[model samples]
Target chain A: MTFPADLVGLLALLGALFVLLGSLGIVKLSSYLLRLHAATKASTLGVGAILLASALHFSARDGGASLIEVLAAILLFATVPVSAQMLARAALHLHPDLAPPQPDSGSRQTVPEGAEVARPNHGNSAPADRL
Target chain B: MIAIAMFITGAAMLLAALRLLLGPTIEDRVLALDTLYVDALALLVLMGIALESRVYFETALVMAVLGFVATVAVAAYLRRGRIMP
Candidate 1:
């Protein structure tokens, strides 16, 4: 299938929006988990759109960069979630003082056996004191 | 077309940098880092095309690999304080 320039423009625009949302979400959200959700979901979509746009743009005139884009997209898709989840779990472990994420409404608010969000207070009265 | 695309992409890149600079937590910073990675990669690809240089090809590929590895490594470390525990 032949890719058109308009489609590339659309993809680039979509990618830009996705990125903007992710950054804004980082500032707007209150919790680490929510931040993870925002950044991972939004940035993934944003980068994916941009990469896809690049692929389409280049594939028409230069075929080589297209494959690199596919590779990059695959790496991005696989890595972001893994990293986000890992970081979230780690943050949960380190900063146990922070409140656990609020349970979703209408969902059975059952805590799994021994599953708890750790709340270790860093005891840092000064925010700059933390590692 | 080039100007418009570059402007949009540049705006996105700046937004991601904002997060990197001001994100409250380590995870947030990591997310910002990831965003920066993608943004930089996209910019590099565009640079390659603009310059018509295959050298950018290798550069982009190296960047892709490095970004993925770095994110994964950082994530694992954040999860457990060690990469292989």
Candidate 2:
């Protein structure tokens, strides 16, 4: 009922809206990568906003700044991208077919057959086992 | 107003669960689960505000750590067919 309460409510509402939109994208998006984009980026922002609201509300109520929510926000922001990257790499390793076709570039350099870059196979039997 | 936010966040979790159930690939399911937990974190924070309690914030923090570890472990398994190898 106070100004701070109103602000908290507004921030919470906006955050929830963003979260819902992200989940909707997860369900509605046609491609796996696109869904990843939605899940990681949008939901991170949404949760960050919600955490901000939480911090604000507690700080106002306690008459002192609450930084716990800020810590949570920092953790969320730091980890979301790491998890997203790992998930994407896993998806690519397991299901390379899901990747969109590479756009043909006119100036793309063709690597010499024997000069291709060496990458760790992560226990796969052969170097060229899977993309 | 907090109630409305809670309702919306619950709906978002439901949608994420739907994706988790019907996802076409393992990665999609993992991603859905990831989103679901993030939404849960937000909901828990909202609940904290609504109840005027700070206890929920600690639980939310733990959830964030656990969720990150779970997602990463699953992703590593998917890629290597083993988590540690």
Candidate topping TM-score: 2
Tens-digit lDDT track of model 2 for B1-85:
9999999999999999999999988888899999988999999999999999999988999999999999999999988889997
Predicted candidate 1 versus true structure: per-residue lDDT over A19-58, tens digit per residue:
6677667667887777778877887787788778777777
Q: Model 1, range B1-85, lDDT digits (tens) per residue?
A: 4345556667767877887888777777887787677667666665654554546657766776787788778877877778876
True contacts kept of each: 0.40, 0.94
* Residue B28 in candidate 1, Cα distance off native in Å: 2.5
TM per prediction: 0.71, 0.86
Query: Candidate 1 docking category?
Result: acceptable
Off by over 4 Å in 2: A105-131
Lowest summed-lDDT stretch of 10 residues in model 2 chain B? B23-32
